[model samples]
Target: MSDPVRPGAVRAATLTRQPAFWVVAALLAAGAVRIAQITGRFLGVYPLATVTAMLLFALLAVPFWLFLSELDFLEREPASLRILAFAWGGLVATSVSIPGSNSLENLIAKLGSPNLAADWGAALAGPTVEEIAKTLGVVAIVLIARPQVNSVLDGVVYGALVGLGFQIVEDVVFAVGAVAQAGQGDQIQPVITTFLVRGFLAGVWSHTLFGALAGAGIGYLVVNPDRTRAHRLAMAGLALFGAWASHVLWNSPLFREGLGDGAVALLAVLVFKGLPPLLLILYLVRRAHDSEAAYYVAKLADLRDPVLITDGELRVLGSGTRRAAARRHAAARAGRRGRAAVRRLQRAQARLAVELSRDADPDLRHSAEVQRQRTALTELGHPEAVEGDPSWRHTVSTVGTTVVAVAVLWAALSFLGNG
Candidate 1:
């Protein structure tokens, strides 16, 4: 599942010949230095706050990293390329956005009225500069490692990572700023408050979401080699616009005045601004995943080998939900070992499918891996890892979880309102 240099990874030989490699390397180095300087100054002034913010945001990044990495698990984006995308987002985009946003903001102030700039400048300026910078991170991937980004999901993975990188770094800066503005010397209270508000509340619909929206566009442009140049470019522009518009809506002051300062109002504002993009990204991810699944699953189906993968297993492999269900189905028969065996079988089958798609002849090592997992599943007493009859337990668990989440959210909002 994790390879240092997977099939789609750019090789040293390839990098040596590509000018874009050297260019990106240089820019990343410069951006890293810029960010270090800014962060260093913050640390010098507010040692406690800066370190706390860094730790908090760094911790926050873990789940996002896992989600995006698994987003395109079948033909997974190379880890090296993924790291590059994150580096670009954290160092390049954040560094550029810091000053680029300010310059654009001043322009907005001069061109429009001060009141207009004060109100709408962030909506306009931040999205325009930041999105461009982040989307360029995707483009840089195309320039340097085109192989890893063969699918639309590949673009989303890279784009979201770039956004995640930028989001974490930007959030850290903002958190420390919040502490400084609290007028309390190097306190963790403001940092914690910012974590709850910005990291917890706004995070789902923040930079990563915008990056995915835009990345979907870039992915469409790159992957659709069949489409006309004009059409591809137009779609990419449309996608970028969607990302920028989403950012604008999130940052705009239009909703703030209408919604009062209460926590419920804040919750409503978050839902109004965030839910649309969240749904959009979900739709895009599902579509991209289905397309990729169909491509790889078809290859496995062509094998027509029961020992390697049966029709039922292929069906399970074709869907993320069914794949999870298969594991649960296995767990019901045996236990944790059954679940683990099912997961391994799925991964092996996926790897074999990917190999079959790329190479006309199946890779022996991958095929052997699939058979090995199948053998383990047999030993676990759940031979076929296909999903069984739908369970009432799953339904009850889902409903119960949903209820608890809603109740907790209501409680938090009520407490905030009271405060």
Candidate 2:
């Protein structure tokens, strides 16, 4: 969605013009070049298979991208930085980590028994090298765009994007490798099977989760610059440690030692291994989002400007479910146009709220954007009905749609697995 405020004064910051933006842009371009170099041989051999694999994984990534984007609703990050994060993960992290991880594995094999290295090499080497490589994407963004990441949630958004980019490319590589392994030149089956296991079964809990954990830590350091250096370092360390430990756990052979004995057992093992970290990251994300929302609510309330944002609007916008319901209510009262206008109004209010929430500043009322959004609310016809009890069915519809999407994907994966 476009920014709602006037272009004259409340113009969106020209992030592309920033030096840091250009630096990240250059890195992303370099990363893309490196990726092309790495994949050229495979692309030359199996152009069709590689393209199909890339498309499938990219399709699977849509819902996740939307979810992470929604998490940063109040203050969306610039698209350039978001794309940069994704490029870093898919290109730079993947390109560098492949050789680095192999070197680590090779060293481990030389130092230890081949059997031990075979079982544990990825567990050790991957966490040490891959986690850092992936996180460096977030760190680089932080270094370049210091003001962009204002909260832990911002870090999670960037981190998840990076991980997502990495996951898509890695999944494509795995799928291509699977086709090669099948050896019958049956492209579809191997690609489908790979997608079933990696994309469906474990995609959510893999690199994306690890990157978010690490990004939160990097965010903590940037967000709380006033905190003690030791405290910030601890936070950063914890973030990296959490990410490494999670990567180690995922890469370890402990689960594969015996759990593949039965189909049910294997499914159980997948759930057992993936669910905990998924739940943990979910919890952290929720906590960060809640803190962010609360901060915005307090800031909006402090403004005490009914013209711009009222207590009722603040209450409704504070919760995700409620926000959805308000839009539904607006649609019911008017039509699609009403819904669109209200959405624009809400976006303007949210932008203003976010601007005001930055460090408890009170003079944000003078911000040009703040004035524009206030004018917008009046012209858009602020509906008093939005503050009323929302239709509970609206919340149900939103959640039901998500549940149905997952079910359809699950069934599709199952069909592929069986065939």
Q: What's the CA RMSD for each of the models? A: 3.1, 4.9
Taken over the whole model, the C-alpha lDDT of each candidate is 0.88, 0.76
lDDT of each residue in 42-126, candidate 2, tens digit only = 6787777777888889899998888877777777877777877888999888887888988999999999978878999989997
Most accurate candidate by TM-score: 1
Model 1, 255-274: lDDT tens digits are 87788777779799889999
TM-score of each: 0.95, 0.85
Which residue segments of model 2 deviate by more than 4 Å?
A: 1-26, 260-263, 357-382, 385-419
| lDDT, residue 292, candidate 2 | 76
Error at 384, model 2, angstroms: 3.8
Model 2 C-alpha RMSD vs. true structure (Å) is 4.9
| Model 2 lDDT-worst window of ten | 1-10
The TM-score between candidate 1 and the true structure equals: 0.95
